[model samples]
Target chain A: MATRGDSAGMNGGGGVLLLLRKDWSIFTLRHRIFVLTVFLMAALQAVVVDEAYFLLGVALAAALAVYVPVIEWYQGTDPMLHSLPVKRGTVVAARHVVTILGMATAGIVWNTTGRILRPILGGGGSDPAFWMTLEGGLTYSLAVAILALLFFPLYFRFGMGRGIAAFAVMTLVLLAVGYGTAQLAAGPAAPGAVGLITPSSVIGSRVDTLLASVGPAATVTVTLAGMAGAFGISIGLSRRWFATREF
Target chain B: MDAVLELRNVCKTYEGFDLRDVSFALPHGYIMGLIGPNGAGKTTLIKMILNLVRPDSGDIRVFGLDAAEQGASVRARIGFVHEQPTFYEGLPAHRVATTVGPFYPAWDEAEFTALAREFGLPLRRKLKTYSHGMRTRFSLAMALAHGAELLLLDEPSSGLDPVFRRDILGRLSAIIAGGNTSVLFSSHLTSDLDRVADYITFLRDGRLEFTLTKDEVLERYALVKGDMSLLTAENRRLFAGIVTGEFGFVALTTNVEQARTALEGQAIVVDRATLEDVVYFTGRTGEGGLRLNGNTR
Candidate 1:
């Protein structure tokens, strides 16, 4: 049964690309009809909503497509995927690429829909300034990518169910901390203590000023660089964790 | 003959179990059955070979290449079927193959289709809808489609009906007839191996009990039954395990000839040991001492 074929059929880059293609094909087809149904429902609702709110549908579709596949992989495909000749990092990288592509496709659909429906909806359909702004686009992309950086490493480490649970726990902890800090500040007992550590107001003001002062191109570059760094670190941690995993 | 797979002093320790310094080589062109009881490190050993579990020490080689160093290349030559076949819940059967097909160099679509058809797998139905037996059949199809040199199957025949089990055993025999593929079948079903396995590797408590050809094992070990008076301390030393009954006593021994010599001129009967006898006796030895009291019930 051992065929006399080359084991190294693909180089490192080609293998990664092949894995990317595989992930894209599987994820898309697996969620194809659902994505289409969601898109149609959004289109039908476009008459009642503005272009900005309508574009949010893309995120919903993309998130559903990506999340469902991740959950399925946790159900059993992780070992099957790991068993393939591809490296663990390569698998993680390919899935990350698929996630990016799904988001990009969703973004394009949103933009195209906005452009076409602007006239009919009597919405600001073709404002080049709003549509072409790098600030909003890059900031949103960075935010999404950062979330992925956090979520994927956990998913790779503990699988989908535990990863989502951990994420929920972390979110709850942060909210509790935020609420406790607000309560402490509102209490007369800690008014001066709160004034001494008003991090949210100071950080928010500084972040707003910094965004305004930075050029669009510079902001985009910086955000991309940060996302890439975080992604690289996440992939490293994931590969290490996967390598030692007993399953 | 060269070994298709070799493990040298391979060791892996989990929270409660330990596979300590396990070593064996499976020669090419033969079916080697890895037999063990529950929690005997059978699945863990298979997982280690597949690089799913890293060994704490030692080496595993497939096709003369190190598993840890050249894992990807080594794995390309091996097809593995886990106890449970896991896939996307809603994905159709064919899509599962398609998604994985491109990763292997010699993936034959026609072969996969033929095998699927032969196995009666529902190509259009989602995997979640398939029965456990059907999923295993599908897993076997995928394993064969890639033209892998070595097949590592872990507990593959546990939850199947008798007809399907026999069919699977028949197919395994046919696969071995080709003289290129070597299978390492892990199972608790000794009867299935008695029919198909050329070699048997028995494990107990994460240790290798014995690794021998089927004929060699049958010729060596035996089941000896006799009166209780025949049960002496010297005779007890010969038994891998012993159990006393009201009628008489029965025990198993690896050195059947020696046992026969020791019990000569007595009302003792030594019969050829089935693989089942060897498994049960050797498998049950570690618990409550070798001198089992009363009925095994």
Candidate 2:
């Protein structure tokens, strides 16, 4: 016969695992489709578009694909989960871990597919081409990882509906600011610079300069720090919000 | 003589209504029924006990543990069946058991399967497809499989048919026969509780009107019917409420023995009050009036 203490520990661990399994089950259809599409798209892009652009597309697609599960995870059904014997903090942590793992797996598939197709579609017999391709993939992964880590916390804190609105408004503001900065950077000489400037180009430029000026090690450290900070803040907010929730 | 559950001045206030200074205790090895009308704060009180909602004032102790401080630990020993069974709609019955079973250390898969079979539940069918009665049975099966020390049921019989309700009550009686467990159930179905509950707690307008043993409730309150001329000022003062018709007067009295002796000559009939009559009488007149279904006197 299991004692009470033994039961508590067993149930706690089992509850988290069971909940994660349920979450993953719901993600099966959408996640698999998104991963497959990303892989195929990355492979095709490698054969046609610039290698840098192919990796960037893969990164962006992987980041956006995460939204499906994140939104589904926080809907009206969560009250059922809260009713279980699991702690609120554990519930929040488990969700974050699941989302992170899903996004990371998608990122890896995108990067690997890009790598395998790059050589076949290269412009010339450039030396150290594989190393250049690896660098581009890593840079894109780091940028996407940071963006996901930041945006996900907002969703967790405010819920899926409000989170989407907040994300859209923020994206629009960033786009406006990015266009304004590009026109200023062009020093009134470049034609249609405002229309030409994209938010991604501005972000890509800043990231490229930081990588060049401070070396890969420093850039990697800063990116990791940013990821950690975003994750930490999101977890804190989620915990507080869930703790006070009447459900 | 440890109390299995205790609620001390537990008060929860909503925008329009308030559960004011509610207090009660259930000793171990007894079944207590929480009876109330619709929107009488039964669910609110249960939610507070489970720590699903915070109480504005008061303390709840379950199994000698502070309910708020040891909520997770307390909940581990509790089996709850809500009015409407809430489960993963997409999951099958067996899957639902698998997901919730591990949460209780004492969860018995064998017992769960047995009860499911006994209730004629289809383990392979998705919960969304189950009928209301079937869903109630599934919830009861899950609640019982874990050997829970304390069972808290909120309107568990609302959608259940008469036969199924009897089955559920019979199972609960058997479960409580072992002398180590207790149950607190809330229902608007007074007859169901009257059949099983040893103790009854009545709530009205978010306050406890009375909490007494079933025998005591029957003993203390009497239904007296006689001519209206028999209702004297002093006799009417002793009784809680009176219904004076053209020919007779019927009233509910707290002191039945005293009323019987005092009005022996004037009273035409005096009978024991059933639990339904008690609930109906209390509900109609918050002052504990007589519910004259017909002019028997």
Candidate 3:
């Protein structure tokens, strides 16, 4: 004899858990083969090129995180999910939590697999390349998480097809800006500086500076605050947008 | 009898259509059939009740709770079967149940398994592999497994076969027999509703044409067939809609007694209108004159 009051709140903690399970099921059920293929490729890349595995893993995480909501929207399951007893805000919250967990797991797997395979591949143990690759995976994941949090509000507001189109336009603009910045960063004499300025190096240097400047505690606090702020804003926007949506 | 669901002056406007001041009530432990032609806003009204789409004005209450403000809580005691019923297409029925079951506090796994078996749904096969009818049946199975006080089904019989439709209706009747669980399903299949619906709500062009007991609906309208001589300007108003051919004319009337009195000795035959006849004629008329299938006279 379960009553309606059992699962009602701003977050609906119980509802969020159920929604996360359901969302995870939907993700795994629909994309198991693609996931297995991604992992298989990561493993093979780890054996041949250790650095490629981390890049591939980070890319896989972002892709999967975006893919779940995109498919849910495209398939028109959002209406069905909303028709259930779950809070609309809880649904959005559950999805964000699941995405973060999934990406974190992907990063961990990449690091662990690369570490295990490096010794077998006859590489120097604990090399700089290996450490940088692992750290690069984290940096890429964090950046993607921030972008994904922003991207989701669009997806929630406009739905899947238009959301993807918006995402594509945003990606193109970011790429254009990045290219222009790199060209500016490297004057006419240094055409290859774009390649010289690897994402890992820039991201790695930024992390080092931030850590050295403010100490570990401040660095961690700032990181958590940024994530929480993005999450809070994204959830608020999505909830408001979703409430007015006509299904 | 308590109203399990009630909509009071519910109104919603779309780009091309509008649900205008619609209202109805389904008493507890009874089946209410929402009947209308395609694009007549049966689905729209249901969506408003479910809060999938908000009403432009008015209120919907389910089990005495405001539907919009308490949407999540209201939905907890309700089960919905969508028209198309999409799911994780790659997962089997059992797996889907497993994933979705915990959302409902009173979900009964054993009952779900029993219903799945009873519906002849292949538990191991993926939903993508199920036929349209099977998918609908699966939706019905899911709707019944939870201890839902009310079930809202949008065209539950559209993709089902005749036998399955009858079976589903029978099962719904059986559910009502237990003294709980009201059902509100929208469909063009009036015969299925006639078989089991205790209450009937008719929608025409987003307006509530009528909402009454099935007996009252059957009694409230009549079909009249007569000759051209009886098609007088004064007599025409009595007919809700009429169609004329070479020999004579056929018309529908909401008030049979008045129609008989008006057309006395005019060589007219009045008969009880079936639910289909009421839907067809009332929905197929126009201004200026009587409308043929695609013509006006």
Candidate 4:
């Protein structure tokens, strides 16, 4: 029963919340199915691989987050969106907030379930299990934030079709570099000692060591800074792109 | 009187068509009917007013504010209904209203709910499930709910049944009776406009043919019916556009008095022209041997 006047005088935070409500309502049956499938897959993987599966689930969820904004952009609903009194930049920014929130929610559920099941499955002790789950969740959130920051601006500037092509090209170039790095790391002269040179192993060792060395506060600070920096850059680019757009 | 809306020398060019130097004004509290055939730039003109498409030149002032410079403020005061109703298909009518209504400062939920009930819109059902008529009604409810002073409708009656069209016109008339509200409806259906429009603006091939009050239009042109043999060279030239038949001759003339005077002895009958006849005659193509000067009647 909220009236129009009630929604007036909304600052950025209030606008983002209103936008989130609208986006949630607009998401259809197909979207629910897609989200459910991702969650189910992640749940099954968690049951099999314990804590590592939770991080994989977050990565997968973050990758899928791109679909929400991309679909909206391609639908060419700007005329309808612009018809409202909301500013164009606010509309663009709100989509990013909604996508990130959705991704975070999925990550929380995945990590929560993994935590509950770790003790029941008798995979590891509670201390290492707790720290591993926390580290995995943070890393997954950070990776997705980086991808969204790099890709969403491109999607906003160019339409979905071209944006997807650009994303694919960028992804392929990164993959090729990753492949070259793997070859150099696996060379005969290199140390093949267990838990030494692999990117995943190195990241896992550093994250656990960091969690142990500094308190959770330090780890959280670094993660918050990285997420904030990514969000800031993406928002800046999105605002610039939207201001010059004809619609 | 202060003009509610004014378009000065507006022009837009597409790949194959061009809207050139189109200009008109609607006084406050008057319903202006934009009458034209298909592809006559009616939608284009409305879009320009809405700032959905920027004009190549000229200025548009809405509610005494420049449209381009103050697009959001101008749009805030205007309500719009497109020919094809588009809404969030996933949301119910009530949710749709909840989502869209908050963006408008003047939106009235009570009014919207009342109108939705009056229009028999199913507030609980998703819009994609609504029939075409129901969707149009929902769109109308949304437009009216915002307490918008100026309503701009583009071909709103195109797909509607006559009964629904009449209901819409009746509701519009009641809305205009409030005295603070005005409407500019573009439609090919002349009968719909005849029922509610106070003024008429005719566009043909993207050019402004004329903009006149409904009474002035009726007075300015006369439909003449007479024998073909009685049609003289000078009188025929006076009739800007004419249709001849075996029974009699029918012609549209701006100076009804002059045509009547010149063809006094030869004429059979002369009657007042309707809005449809005025549009048809004025929209006729080049050089039909009818030279129109100033006011005809």
Considering every candidate listed, which one attains the maximal TM-score?
A: 3
| Per-residue lDDT of model 2, residues A1-247, tens digit only | 3322353563356555755776665554655687577657656655445544444554545454454445454434454555556676666777666656755665666556555666667634344442244345445555555555555555655666776688678877876787777678877887575654432354455656778889888877865676567667767877776666564
Q: Give per-residue CA lDDT, model 1, range B116-228, as digits (tens).
A: 99988889998889999888888889898988899999878877789988998998888889988999999999999999999999888888888899999999888888887
Interface RMSD values, listed in order for every candidate = 3.5, 3.6, 3.2, 3.0
Kindly give the stretch of ten consecutive residues in candidate 2 chain A with the minimal lDDT sum: A123-132
List the RMSD of every prediction in angstroms.
4.9, 5.3, 3.9, 6.3
lDDT-best of 1 and 3 = 3
Clash pairs, candidate 2, are none
Cα lDDT of model 4 by residue, A177-242, tens digit? 756676667785765423323223434455567778886789878877888899889889977876
Q: Each prediction's TM-score against the native?
A: 0.84, 0.79, 0.87, 0.77
Better of 2 and 3 by lDDT: 3
Indicate the TM-score of model 3.
0.87
Q: How many residue pairs clash in each candidate?
A: 0, 0, 0, 2
**How accurate locally, in lDDT, is each candidate?**
0.73, 0.72, 0.77, 0.74
Error of 3 at A53 (Å): 6.4
Better of 1 and 4 by TM-score: 1
Provide the DockQ value for model 1.
0.39
lDDT of 2 by residue, B1-297 (tens): 579999999888889999999889999988999988777889888887777788988989999998776777787788888776777666788987876666766778888999999989999998889997888889888888888899999999988889889999998899899887899999899899989999999888898988899888888888887886777777777576567666677677788878888887764688888776666555433234443555623
Residue A95 displacement (Å), model 3: 0.6
In angstroms, give how far residue B22 of model 3 lies from its true place: 1.3
Please provide, for model 3 over B101-186, each residue's C-alpha lDDT reduced to its tens digit, 9 standing for 90 to 100: 66776788888889899999999998889998998889888888888899999999989999888888988898899988999988
- Fnat: each model in turn: 0.53, 0.29, 0.52, 0.39
